[model samples]
Target: MVKWSISILLIMLLNLAVTSLGNVPNFDYHAFYFIHQWLPSYCNQKGTKCCYPPTGRPAADFTIYGLWPYNDGGNSLQNCPGSSYDVAPLKAIQNMLQKDWPSLTCPQIGRKFWLHEWNKHGTCSKSVLDELAYFHAASNMKNKLNIFEALSKARIIPNNQFYQVENIKAAITQATGYRPFIFCNHDAEGNSQIWQVIFCVDKSGTKLVNCSGSPQGQCAYSTVKFPSY
Candidate 1:
């Protein structure tokens, strides 16, 4: 009787672990909320960890911070609440740029300005939309490429082989035109992550440094940089 009880307990524990590991959060407004609550804590911000850890081993030299908006084949703009359009992330990036180049205009910042806006709020004002259209038209003329094709070429391999250094550099170049400000990625197991830009460096290399963490301890490090994009 004692042996049977112990075996059953072990089986239950194993099953629970598998179930927890396999669960991926559904993408919705609640997804952002879940990421906000869980990611920081998982990275040891407040000494709490996630239920399912990331698969990538933590890096010793890099830090990635801030959350990159995830679009799970749905329109984020359609899902955001309120009339204001939830443009907090673009405003945040604009504020950052103003600190460096006070005279910079929205158009001068190039595709990055639009990418940041779309990534965060899922939509943009008419001016930004016009700028994006112009940028895409010009880019196609110069490179014989379209936005859809570019994005298709830029997709990352969503597997354990994610930390490919060459692929990372290529992705950064393709997305941002300039080299990455940082080089970090989302862990497969976590619902959300954050990458904060510490500061800029004047050196020939990348300008920003960031830290990344999962909603669990699966990926934890401070020096991760954003990919060139």
Candidate 2:
């Protein structure tokens, strides 16, 4: 009789543990960042040298970086199970991608950087999107938030001019109706330059959402440089 009670108690305890764990939230990814980099700023950073894509020099613009998944704790999710990156599915928008998402590294190659982004970050976003859908969403996002145009409208040309970080954020916010987080890099002379503009995105990866956490890097300087291409 005592043994039976002990066994039942143990079973009950095990069941309770399982139930508690099951109720725990899936904090793996509830939001994401639609991140893009300023090509001129990137090329101007200290100890950096950039090469144009085979098609030719891309225009002076903020280029597509990645659609990164983020957990509630602000950790980026990566390497989840999903299809590997393939160019076949992206043929329809190949030209657009080449223009917006081109690799600026030495010995630039077509689709290589994209393939890396897909396998590393895009795969982890499979619960909300597929390979083709992911790339398409990124393209749509780029079209929607024309950062260059937004800044240009504010007369913030990338001609080695310095601007307050708050003003930069204000321009993007005024244009998109969603606030952006800016990251900075240092120029050859160690002056801070804006590198990436990141926007928060919801789980659907469709619409804009407010970001939760603070941005990394030093964008808090009194003035940040906007380098020319």
Worst 10 residues of 2 by lDDT: 213-222
RMSD of each: 21.2, 3.5
- Candidate 1: segments with Cα more than 4 A from true spot: 1-48, 51-152, 183-229
- Tens digit of per-residue lDDT, candidate 2, span 103-195: 787654568889889988998888878888888888889888999999999999888999988999999999999989888888888989888
lDDT for model 1, on a 0 to 1 scale? 0.31
Q: lDDT scores for all predictions? A: 0.31, 0.85
Q: Pick the candidate with the highest TM-score.
A: 2
Model 1: per-residue Cα lDDT over 2-73, one tens digit each: 999999999999999999977944333211101111122224333333332122222221222222222333
- Candidate 1 deviation (Cα RMSD): 21.2
CA lDDT of 198 in candidate 1? 20
